[model samples]
Target: MHAERLYPILLLLGSNIFMTFAWYGHLKYKSSPLMIAIAVSWGIALFEYCLQVPANRLGSAVYSAPQLKGMQEVITLLVFAGFSAWYLGEPLKWNHWAGFGLIVVAAWLIFLD
Candidate 1:
């Protein structure tokens, strides 16, 4: 059960990475027209959804749909925070950390039995 749960979480992490890049990497390609950027990002996001769908289906065997969705939302924020700090070269300020801490607490509350 634990391993099964971990599978979807890992997939969600990978999907989030691809998604973050697809959605925001366009900023680095500002010279491209908006339509071109949207097209490219949409192409990349297709793969994200590919992994995400199966992840949720597999995850549903162990967790309720709402639970899986909640988990994915939390992971999305976490992945975005790391990607922004590392890839985007944004400074992770104290307030950002504090906000993430609150999000973690919220996740914990949601997952609590």
Candidate 2:
């Protein structure tokens, strides 16, 4: 695809990476104070929003709001799945994979005219 379409995808990917860390990275640091974790997560989330907002804005030129949101959800799940397994040491069960597959199908349906 053209840069117009590709750029937003890249931005969203980057944003989701940051978001996954922000949301779940602290699980490994349970010994840290809750206040400290919250503060750090908020800082990381600020960067996520920075990228996410621009991604949606640029993507809006080529995609509808619902389409953008659908894409974001898919990206989030994919990123979280990997992050959960690799970084969080959480193994996804068969049912989790099936649920994720269903969500992927739902995302595909959102693109249908």
Candidate 3:
């Protein structure tokens, strides 16, 4: 694939990394105040949007809205899985894989012409 198509995927990957951290990194600090967690998550989410907005805009040129959404959902799960295991030390189980596999199939269906 050309750079134009590839760029969005890269941006999405980067965005998902930040997105995962923003949404769930707070879990590691449960003893902290909820207000502080929300504030910190908001800060991190700002960076996520920085990449996400551009990714969607650039990807729109090459992919449909549903395709972009599908891609983002799949990317989000993949990033979350890694972040969950590595950062939180919580490994995924068979059920998670089964569900995620179905999502991959759904994405494949979305991509069909």
TM-score per candidate, in order?
A: 0.90, 0.97, 0.98
Candidates' RMSD to native: 1.5, 0.7, 0.6
Better of 1 and 2 by TM-score: 2
What is the TM-score of candidate 1?
A: 0.90
| Total colliding residue pairs, candidate 1 | 0
Q: lDDT for every model? A: 0.86, 0.96, 0.95
Expressed as tens digits, the lDDT of each residue in 18-71 for candidate 1 is: 899899988877899999999999999998999899899899889887788778
For candidate 2, lDDT tens digit of each residue in 5-86? Answer: 9999999999999999999999999999999999999999999999999999999999999899889999999999999999
What C-alpha lDDT does candidate 3 achieve relative to the native structure? 0.95
Q: Give the candidate number with the greatest TM-score.
A: 3
- Model 3, range 6-111, lDDT digits (tens) per residue? 9999999999999899899999999999999999999999999999999999999999999999999899989999999999999899999899999989988999
- Specify the highest-lDDT model's number: 2
Residue 63 local lDDT, model 1 = 86
